[model samples]
Target: MLYKLNLEHILFLDIETVPQRPSFADLDENSQMLWEQKSQYQRKNEITAEDFYERAGIWAEFGKVVCISVGYFTLKDNERNFRVTSFSGEETRLLKQFKQLLQEHFNLAKHLLCAHNGKEFDFPYIARRMVINGMNLPYKLDLFGKKPWDVPHLDTMELWKFGDYKHYTSLKLLAHVLGIPSPKEDMDGSMVKDVYYNENNLDRIVSYCELDVITTAQVFLKLRNEELLGRDEIKKV
Candidate 1:
């Protein structure tokens, strides 16, 4: 009998976003003043979109996803292999692709979707983008009003809280603690916006997004073994 996890059903995703460009006509006097102050600060500190994403809480409005990367992992022969895919284009196109991928490979009842800070950010961001694109959401993503533990959704950041909510842990920090090699150490999320703007390099954004999914998967494995299994040992299959 095979005891492998159904990798085809698991989706790990991450996104990169940039601020919405404000129109001159749309800006009120107060808004213009605020924009000027923000512009000056951005120039002074050399802040990039990714920096704003991680630190400024701007994804609420100014942010628009420039890239979304997904990784699907499965166990074969007691080892994990991942199939990665990414979309870098308009939000509508990327979201449509994401929806199609979900429909083609995963069944809502059997598969799980995982992320790092998905509950608070990634999931909602994706959901809103889909709606904005006039796309119907997949069944698995319809977790509104569902309890966190009841859904087939796993967020490694939430898991790392370990029942104490006082401190927040980043994916990079969790990966380090779990002995997983940090893929984004050379490039933080803050650099993503500039990379997209200056270099017009979609590949860089995709790579960053994929790295996040990979790191999130690693953290999930660690948390599953430690918190759920109550043991440090994990059988790959």
Candidate 2:
């Protein structure tokens, strides 16, 4: 199935998120109580809610998306060229730009939104954030009433599982095992919150997010036994 897939039809994406507020104290009294309750399932008895707040990005309700980087493969001089772009900044603005991209370019029946662990994280987070930001859900993301086989989304992690629900794989590890170059020279998900709130470096975050997009597209291509994008073939926009 992967071998027959049209590379240009997939919008490979990755999102970077951070806590809705810089710190737990930033939340209002009502929100603080709510967060305390929400953190119960994931936090240990000894770990306070404030201490666990750094991980808020993992949950859509407690976090806001900061960056969404996407890429697609196209032919250039008879070779695959990867073009990467990013929508980043204030949560609403970033989401709006991404929505516009979907409505205008990727709004076709054959188009799909692909990501690593997207079905469980990136896809739902974007959909929920869109609704929260007072925007309508795009056609490719609004899974309402869609049949099991009709969802126009592809998850690289899910594809790697091959129906083994018990297995889990990280994108970085998959790339390493598959001999793809590592993109984690600077920072990782654990440091995104500090980098965004403390250091105030959206550019660095954007760079990291873009690397994930390229790595995701590379991993997908490798799955199909196809040649990966060359260094000179990656274009930034």
Candidate 3:
């Protein structure tokens, strides 16, 4: 029997990134100007440039993904079993591996790729990197032109909106309200760039990515169980 909807085809993924540097002295003038502006703002706020740099780095580093972790889970005889894997080699190699896994094990046309904010962040990031590497994006990501609900993609953050569409709720906050264990209490996305850059540790990055996936999966499960809403409400699949 088929388990939960698209249970066998569900893949939860997350990535970590670090800023690209130009040997300090060779940093471009445009970058220097932007840093100076940020430094002035930091001074007004009583924060150091190092602090601002780390906060601003997530986007710059987003263009330089250092690690991607994907978690696959399926229900077997009423129990859910999950396998978490990390792809942490060069960016090109990791992107290739991700494609290979999708081709070999998943049907892009049928599988549901669930993410926290994938529609806005993860999916586009992966697609752009794949294109840069001359890799063909999987068919499932072809829903760029389709309506949000018409496609198989699901973003938990969007679901949390529940048609209100007011304030944006964070994954950590949702987990707290829903009683799911917070996975990365030890580290937030803000520190990912530093963890990879300063420590040169891929394992820490992998751990952070994996924890995000796990938290996402937990949120999905909560939605599936009807534990996140009122009885008269219909859950969005």
Candidate 4:
């Protein structure tokens, strides 16, 4: 299936999210109570909701997307070049900008939106976030009544699963096993919330997100038995 894919038509992407507020106390009274209720089943018995608040970023209702990094392949003279761009800063502003980019460039039958664990995390998360922000769903992202074959979203992680539903693979692990360059020489997802809230380092987060996008694209290439992109071939847009 991969060997038949048109790499240029796939828009590879990754996103970074953080809790909407820096701390649990920053949440309004009603919101704080709501979060406590939401975390009831997920948080351990010994962990209070306040102690578990840091994990809120994993939930779309309690989190906001801070960066969405994307990459695409272009073939020139039989060589492939990858160009990446990131939409960062104010959450709604970035989401709106990203939507426009998709509507303009990738809203087609041949285009796909690819990510690592996108079917479970990135894809639905982005759509739910957009709905919360009162934005119309982009054509590719919204799969309300679309048939399975009609969905344009692709997941590299799912491809690696090979029908082993009990197994899970991290992008870092898959890239490492495939001999693709690791993107986590610096901070990883665990530190994204702190980096955004405490360090005020959105540029750093964007860099990490973009690296994940690149690594994901490379992993897809490896899966397809295609040539991987060298360090020199990646150009930031």
TM-score of each: 0.74, 0.98, 0.77, 0.97
Model 2 per-residue lDDT tens digits across residues 9-79:
98999999999999999999998999999999899999999999989988889999999999988875777
* lDDT for position 26 in model 1: 45
Shift in Å, residue 200, candidate 3: 1.0
Each model's lDDT comes to 0.66, 0.93, 0.68, 0.93
Clashes of 1: 4
lDDT of 4 by residue, 33-75 (tens): 9999999999889999998999999999999999999999998
For model 2, the stretches where C-alpha displacement exceeds 4 angstroms are none
**Residue 179, model 2, lDDT:** 92
Q: Kindly list the per-residue Cα lDDT of model 1 for residues 1-237, writing each as its tens digit.
A: 012545456788888886544232344566446555665555446764333333322343445677878877655776556666788788778877778877888756778788888878888887776776677888777777877665777677876786787768888888888877665355777776567666788877777777787677667766555221111222221
Alpha-carbon RMSD of each model: 6.8, 0.9, 6.6, 1.0
- Superior by lDDT: candidate 2 or candidate 3: 2
Q: What TM-score would candidate 3 get against the native?
A: 0.77
Kindly report which residue stretches of model 3 are placed more than 4 angstroms away from their true locations once superposed: 1-4, 22-26, 29-57, 60-62, 144-150, 226-237
TM-score of candidate 4 versus the correct structure, residues matched by position: 0.97
Across 73-163, the per-residue lDDT of candidate 3 in tens digits comes to 6556765566778788588898888888777877656787888877777777777778767777887665667776667677888778887
Ranked candidates, highest TM-score first: 2, 4, 3, 1
